[model samples]
Target: MKRLLLSAALFVSITAFAQTYPKYTNEAGTPKSTSKPPAARLKSDGTEMRSETVMPSRITGDFQEIMERAVIQNKEHNYAAAISLYTQALNVANEEQAWRALVSRATTYQTMDKPNLDKAIRDLTTIIDAQNAPQKQLAYIYTCRGRILQEMGDIAGGCADALKAKELGLPVALMAGLEGCK
Candidate 1:
């Protein structure tokens, strides 16, 4: 009789738990649409047209506000505040957005007194080396790393990074100080 009761209790508990959970559809629904709908090109009639479901501006505005605050702190030479804000942004940001914040914060560290220049260099270098990093982004990381090395008086290493930046097609102007070091 005790065994029968225990089995009933287990079955009831499992049923209750299962029913309380919401059903997930296809693992959060089919993968997000990658391709844009066909462009709404103007017809000869020239009637006005627009895409359906415009993205909300508030989402982008929030990210921009956070990034702007980080930039302002860096400009004011408040490295700690800038780094903190950048980290907050990174936590909520997409892949490209996070990379931008990390690169900016690394530069802020280089600009601070008694800066951990080696760590800054390493941070930028790792981002540059990322296999999936966007192509245009590699130049920016190399430029930042070069500046940190140049500031620390490692002319040879700085020049190498600067050259790498240039080879990646960044404008020569970004490597201004390292030009002579080359």
Candidate 2:
């Protein structure tokens, strides 16, 4: 009798859990259309034109795992291990993931006890030079790099990046540093 009641309770809990959970259509199921609709382009004649949806290449599972581990190491203050793991993740990263990994590494550099701000600038520069990410992300990166430049006494470089970020929709230049930036 006790076993029967326990079994009933387990079944009820499972049913309740299943019903409350949102359905996922990904794993071992039909493919899902996760891509956003392509932007419409106008020809010289001003006619509506359809374009293919641009989907970025997905990063590898290994990249995900390595980044997760790196985050854990970073939170634990294991700077060396975290940086090494972040580098490993970079080697396996795809288009979008490339920016993610680079930014993460740059931040790690910024947070180190004896911070390597120069290396941080280099990593952020790699992202800016790539010019492959969305405008919003580029804006954020520019803002970050600009702040770093300001700290490093490069007022002109900071102003340039800050202005670029403003052009990209994040107007933080004047607030970050007013030096040589009108």
Best by TM-score: 2
lDDT of 1: 0.56
lDDT tens readout by residue for model 1, 1-182: 53344234323432433354332222332333212123455777997454321222312324456778988988888888887776665444544444555666666666576577765665576466543345555765676676567667776877888788778886664444453555
| Candidate 1 deviant stretches above 4 angstroms | 1-62, 131-133, 179-182
- Cα deviation of 21 in candidate 2 (Å)? 23
| Consecutive 10-residue window with the lowest summed lDDT within model 1 | 52-61
Local distance difference test values of all predictions, in order: 0.56, 0.64
List candidate 2 segments past 4 Å from native: 1-61, 171-180
Candidate 2 at residue 103, lDDT?
72
Model 2, span 1-182: residue lDDT tens: 53344234323432433353222212322232222223555889999764222224443446667888998999898988888777766656655556666777887887777788877887788788877556776776786787678778898888888788889886442234324676
Local lDDT at 155 for model 2:
82
Q: Find the candidate with the highest lDDT and give its number.
A: 2
Instruction: Assess the local accuracy of residue 94 in candidate 2 as a C-alpha lDDT between 0 and 100.
Output: 55
Q: Which pairs, if any, clash in model 1? A: none
